[model samples]
Target: MHEFQLPDMTCGHCAGVVGQTLHLADPACKFQVDLPARKVTVQSDEDRAVLAEALADAGYPPA
Candidate 1:
């Protein structure tokens, strides 16, 4: 599992976009987003750097 702190994620819409972006990157991955906490926990076989890059490319770079 990979945990990321996304300081820019301020609302449900942000979370939804992040979720959709990650899902598109790796459909089999599982993840949970905590909007209030500005955190995201992802479970996937993909490399951490790759996942992080994907999120960054989608405009939700981790803090």
Candidate 2:
């Protein structure tokens, strides 16, 4: 599992977008969004930098 902070994620829609983006990047990836913590945890075999770029491209630049 990998962890990142997505400060811009504020609602279910944002969560959905983030989730979808990750899925699009790596369909087998599993994610958990902790809205209050502004954190996202992803379980994937993909590279972290690639995932980060995918998230950025999806509009939720990680912290």
Candidate 3:
């Protein structure tokens, strides 16, 4: 799994946006958003950098 640490992702809305962004990038991806931990764990065939870039372009750059 690819884990992203989103420092500003702190709410359900952020999680939803993250989900949408990831789904747009990789429809087959499976993920979980942990708000308290500010983390997003993704299982995808896409490269980690691709996923990270997608998230970054969506304004949630991973740490």
Candidate 4:
């Protein structure tokens, strides 16, 4: 699993965007988004860097 702490991901809308970004990055990936903690946990075969890049490009850069 890959975990990203996205400080900017503060609401349901942000969570949706992050989910969409993850899907675009890796359609087969499964994920759990925690808006309260501003974290995203993903289970996938994709590279961690690729996921991170995708999230960052979507305006939710991980910290």
Candidate 5:
């Protein structure tokens, strides 16, 4: 599992965008988003760098 801290993710819209973006990158990926904690935990076959890059591209770079 890969975990990321998204400090700028503060609303449902942000979470949705992040979730959708990741899913588009890897359909089989599973993730848990914690809004209050501003964190995301993901389980996927994709490499960590790839996932991080996708998130960064989608404007949710991990902290």
Candidate 6:
């Protein structure tokens, strides 16, 4: 699992968007977004950079 800090994620809608975007990037990947903690954990074979790009494209840039 890979963990990313998404400080800008502030609501259920944002988490849903991020989760959907992540799924769109890699359909088999599993993810959990903790909006209160500003963190996301992803389980996948894809590289972190690829995931980061997907998050960025989804409007929730990862740190």
Choose the strongest candidate by TM-score: 4
lDDT of each: 0.93, 0.93, 0.95, 0.96, 0.94, 0.90
Give one digit per residue, the lDDT tens place, for model 2 in 1-61.
8898999898889999999999998999999999888789999999999899999998889
RMSD to native, candidate 6:
0.7
Each model's TM-score, in the order given?
0.95, 0.95, 0.97, 0.98, 0.96, 0.94
Task: Estimate, for each residue in 12-42, the C-alpha lDDT of model 1 and write its tens digit.
Answer: 9999999998898889999999999999999
Question: Could you tell me the TM-score of candidate 2?
Answer: 0.95
Report the C-alpha lDDT of model 6 over 1-63, residue by residue, as the tens digit.
Answer: 889999889999889999898898889999987788999999999988999999998888987
**Model 5 residue pairs with clashes:** none
Q: Which has the higher lDDT value, candidate number 2 or candidate number 4?
A: 4
lDDT of 4 by residue, 1-63 (tens): 999999999889999999999999999999999889999999999999999999999999999
Q: Which ten contiguous residues of candidate 3 have the minimum total lDDT?
A: 7-16
Report how far off residue 41 is in candidate 5 (Å).
Answer: 0.4
- TM-score of predicted model 5? 0.96
Cα lDDT, model 6, residue 50? 96
Give candidate 6's error at residue 2 in angstroms. Answer: 0.9
Q: In candidate 6, list every pair of residues with a backbone clash.
A: none
User: Model 4: residues >4 Å from true position, as ranges?
Assistant: none
lDDT of candidate model 4 versus the reference: 0.96
- Give per-residue CA lDDT, model 3, range 1-63, as digits (tens): 899999979889999999999999999999999999999999999999999999999989999
